[model samples]
Target: MTKPISGFSKLTKEEKIDWVTANFTQNAAQSKKILQTYWNQNDSVQQLHDEFIENTITNLYVPQGIAPNFLINETLYAIPMAIEESSVIAAASKAAKFWLKRGGFKAKILGTEKVGQVHFIFKGDAKKLESFFTYLKPVLLAESASLTKSMEKRGGGITDIVLKNKTDELANYFQLHATFETKDAMGANFINSCLEQFATTLKKEATRYDAFSRQEKDVEIVMSILSNYVPNCTVRAEVSCPVEDLKLSAELTPQQTAEKIIQAIKIAQIEPYRAVTHNKGIMNGIDAVVLATGNDFRAVEAGVHAYACRNGRYSSLTHAQIENGIFKFWIELPLALGTVGGLTNLHPLVKLNLEMLQRPSAQELMQIVAVAGLAQNFAAVSSLVTTGIQKGHMKMHLLNILNQLGANENEKATLTEYFKTNPVTHHGVEIQLSSIRK
Candidate 1:
């Protein structure tokens, strides 16, 4: 049973914590201690973390790790990953190392165009609307010059604008579809600024258009924003080697292993349920790099998932094929990333992560992220075909179980060695932990 309190947001930080603990926590003092324990000791750094978002209590920490030996496009890299999931880093590293001797990964940028839209309703003649749009196009672009000037100077700016009539979808529904080339940056802010300006200009011009009646001229702007579904902002990463080159282990012959891997991927490609999880594995790699480099993982995830279902079926993002004694695995994803804006220059760890990768441009980062995803999928599917995904996943999950059961260092060491040969399960670990404590 909880009671509501007014002015919760306006309370002082200490007062807010007190109210939360008093109303919710069984042990208020311990709860307070736990929250404060995670705060940075450095005052300035703590302050910086607090301002990152609203209603900050304490920092929620995710392990920042590196998956080394990622050889992409004739260059070697150690990719930074920030995630809470067990086995993700280990799996990525294993995959990277496995491919290091097999010519590594090759990645290329397919496109860098981003999209934005200005939606409005025009209860007017279609012919008149078209005529008005023709005259308004250059004016809209010209009005946005101040906003796009800096981006244009950096070799990135608005690429094209087109008026789309969607009146059939909904009466008077229309959109000003715009495309952009945002080099070395995610360009959300730039695109959005330009779009708002377009919206304003459209409204102002419609008010003065000589050909429009009063009702027709009153164009109601629904919204102006950049779209996260950036199908045109895409990259591809692939790994190919001779069928005989996949000498991963002696348990399965290379040809058999290749067949199994391809079949596993094929099942995912045709099945929606499996494809969702399969694509999730790919995102585990992509998102880690995106977050480490101070880019928007949410935007990347949404766009990538949308792209996965672009063929009318939600299939696997990673594809596989075998032809002429050659085996190939690849993935193409729409990753809208940035290296010069947002958190790249703000957060300390983000700066370090970017510097560790030798300061890649947006395109370079895209290639790197795509390679990470491809490697991750290869490792996951390879394991699934051979030893089963759970074996390695459970092993990586052992530490988390141990921490949860409050195992001491000595107990953890013994259990760690024992589980190397035995399967790790929550119940099994708990029983062993209880026996050890007794």
Candidate 2:
């Protein structure tokens, strides 16, 4: 509501929560929980979290943190995120360091507006029913609050609406598409809230939307849910590394390192199965931020994967290339996403993250998120080009192996060296475990 906050700061925790709720559309249940979780200390058997996860989740607070030094479009901005992951901060920072000298990324948004689908099914002629929609269009346009004031103030809001009919292998269904622009808040809550009222007028126009039940066979409004396949908007970030900047090791040539990243991206583009993992790697940064902000990570993931197959071939959500000795990156996903309005306002950490980001508009949030995705992808590809994913992953995993036996730093290093030479297995670990014990 307040210019899609890039950060939430200077307010008491309660005020911060209030500010987020007033600005965005929060589920009623989530809002209540946010309030109760702050005051209530009941630690009964009713808690769903296991002891380990509970250590982080206690008090139902997931603080939001801002990622700094995001140089996008000549603007240095702070990004808000809700997540708990080791090395993400480190990775983003390292990635930013890699790009800083080469020239910061220039990122752009396709737009800020999103789409909502209100499905209505009834026994009527497709053409005549379509005409009925045409008749109702003017009426929908005439309504006030039809356009969000917050969006319209910033030059975005409901631009158009259409009704279309599509048939599946099962049957034909009617889908009413409400195309609206929400300025800073993710518009799902706004669109759904609007549709709740609009459905009233729609039911009056069509008999099918009016009735229900097994007692009679009639057209029904089965489920009215917001679609995350936001085609109207896309965010892109591009950074060029001079061929010289790619050097991380003496053995690898800058061009070869860039080439390896390009080759990996090419594989992701061509292979659907690999693309899934490829995108998942990118989402490691994305979902962590989403969870940190109280936004729906699952919905964002679903829509991104669904959008990946827009051309009917499963492919990577991101595209990377090496041109003129510089590595370029771009990602196009239906970032129909938000920072406030749901659990973002409920959870503690998420609140902290938004406070740090201070983003007021959804478009700004998307820009930061898109940049993070690009940065994360770059880190992933860079890591792959140098040492490979397994080695880096195993490096972190080895710490756990060392800790289980209380090995000191030097001992842990020695154990890692042992694993590098030996066949890694539980049985092998046990054998080494004995040797280390002695």
Candidate 3:
């Protein structure tokens, strides 16, 4: 049995699956959906069409397991995530269990506002394009000033909007940076709505032009896309653990473990090339939750990479430190995520996760996400510093094999002994299982 810690409940291996199956709510709700909007069986756009001859996308219903032991922003939260990776759920829960000996994760956010961009493409003529935007900017702003949604009225709206010119190999293009204020939403749908409205107005004004009449003078829209350069909202989480508790399972001095883990992370952060894989490990935790909740995982993925290289120095999404024998950690990913929009509220698994977390506010969910990231990092680092990651994970792999082989209790014991003694082989397992059945 695992040692007990405050604000956390320890589960045996069996209970973990039960918990996931419960809160992920596989039994209570219908998970499978053949919809045009979301596709999981078919992972991406190219794969869906060329490979699979299916028009409808498959909405995946992966398990949303709660990572126990987190207290962020004065609220205790059991983070619920959906991911299929072997170690992520286990590693995060292990770290949370250890951290429970302390006060758990404390976190804060800068604000809940987000920013989006809309690109406007013009013709190849440089001087002609310049003259068009010069006239269009005033028309674009003045005509759409009152068009500001509830966001602008409620102390936050399109505070800053600007246009930029680009000369790429394809053609000359202009982009409208619509820096809008999204109070709590990640603002993808809302911003896109505003962009559609603004774009329609701009195109309408262009039709009545008494200006440049050449065929190339028209605002040829290459792509009026929404930009992922998020607003100034930053999320931070801090978790501390008792040294005495960590010393039990890990067998290393708490300070030594912390130092070793932090050093490995520093290496991952310092190098740009290594930082790619490093941040991937972080996203192993983030993407799971985002996917589970039916939020835009792609946007979160974009924001993370964008945030990593923001300062020209490539760094890990999370930072860890040992201060006064306390393991302090913080992650500042651009969690430009929304709770109210997209499939977040539609999917059953996501709804269950949200309910299990006690239905936190938008900002609170971001903090919880950061906490999961912190726990996941700590989990991975602790194992790497002490016993190496494969030690626990490999055992789980063996158990999975056993389940796949359909070994009964007595046969499982016999197979375990055989596995421990003999060289491993998939063919051998099939033959042996066949013989046992016969």
Candidate 4:
């Protein structure tokens, strides 16, 4: 059994790695060597990575790929994606190319409201609490002025604060629900700072209110935090063309292809099991761009799923239809993205990716991200209704399978070309490689 070590964080990086490998790993020397091998060659870059987190081990690298020919809002862009999954970039690029000749994608921001909350417990009269909140609302905003000043100067700040009563759900539960306009930054830190101040102010002012009894005055603050469920911070991306021009494959007529795509989306809409995987396919494109741009993909994921289930049933994020003679497909996503803060300013690759995007504003980035998702869904559903998803996915996964079997470069090249015509499967690839070697 391994014993817990004291002051682990205080140890030097080498000492930490040494202790970790010696205690936990079967082959400490090999583990240490592998860890060191992944470290950046440039001292400065390696040091920067080390400081990104505590008890630093080694950087875990994900491949950064570019999905080109994404035409959003009449502007062509090569969107950068950082993900480990195979076929995501390929699927997104294929979708983008398919839409390029059909006049590209149209995107626009629907809203940009983010939310924060200060939850508290108040064991007092409901009427008195409401009266006190009416008076305390201005104080909450006033006390957080210094924190919001800079954001306000940038034309982004606290929009409104409302008092919500939740006693029916949980005893003595109330919240100060505040909304904000964060402009080009995600503004999580800013919103959280202001919320903390509001919590402080609420507690302080409650003690002085003449209408409140002693028990009411003793308001207990639970927590103050920014919400990741930003339904209002939304963007819409869409592509449409005449039904006759919707020739996705030579196997199906334009009308049949359009109907199949719509039917696939409809299935996702009603079926939760299908919707989860369907949305995941869309997120493959969305998260790749979100990670490459240095935003919080986890937060985006949470908010988007919450939005999907907002109507009480989880459903598809992408919708398709044939309106008259036109075939239309689109997605509206809740994306709270930033172009100016967090990793956007710190990570070298993030900065480069933003520049490659022509330095899009938060709204523009939202539109771009939404388009990526819509494109991905279109590609996935189109493939599903025609050639089947595995046909293309397995083909893209063939290289990983080959490399895993330790095939040489020439073998890999030949096998890749062979799989272009032949079906790609692990067992088949192994047999083919073995025959070639023989």
Per-residue lDDT for 1-438 in model 4, tens only? 999899999999999999999999999999999999999999998998898788999999999999999988889999999999999999999999989998999999999999999999999898998888889888888889999999999999999999899999999999999999999999999999999999999999999999888898999999999999999999999999999987768899999999999999999999999999999999999999999999999999999999999999999999988998999999997999999988899888899999999999999999999999999899899999988998999999999999999999999999999999998889999999999999
Number of the candidate with higher TM-score, 1 or 2: 1
Worst 10 residues of 3 by lDDT: 28-37
Query: On residues 127-146, what C-alpha lDDT tens digit does candidate 1 reach at each position?
Result: 99999999999999899999
Model 2 ranges with Cα > 4 A deviation: 1-69, 77-87, 143-156, 168-172, 207-219, 343-348, 358-360, 404-433
Clashes of 4: 0
Go through the candidates in order and give the clash count of each: 0, 34, 0, 0
Best by TM-score: 4
Cα error, residue 284 of model 2, in Å, equals 0.4
List candidate 4 segments past 4 Å from native: none
Please give the ranking of all candidate structures by TM-score, highest first, separated by commas: 4, 1, 2, 3
lDDT string, candidate 2, 132-199, tens digits: 67777766655636546665786666788788777653365777787777665677777876665556
Every model's TM-score: 0.97, 0.75, 0.73, 0.99
Candidate 4 or 3, higher lDDT: 4
Cα lDDT of model 3 by residue, 99-191, tens digit: 675777788887555665556666656666567667877777676666565667655566666666666644565677677666555677667
Best by lDDT: 4
lDDT, candidate 1, at 287: 89
What is the C-alpha RMSD, rounded to one decimal, of candidate 4? 0.9
Candidate 3 lDDT score at position 84: 73
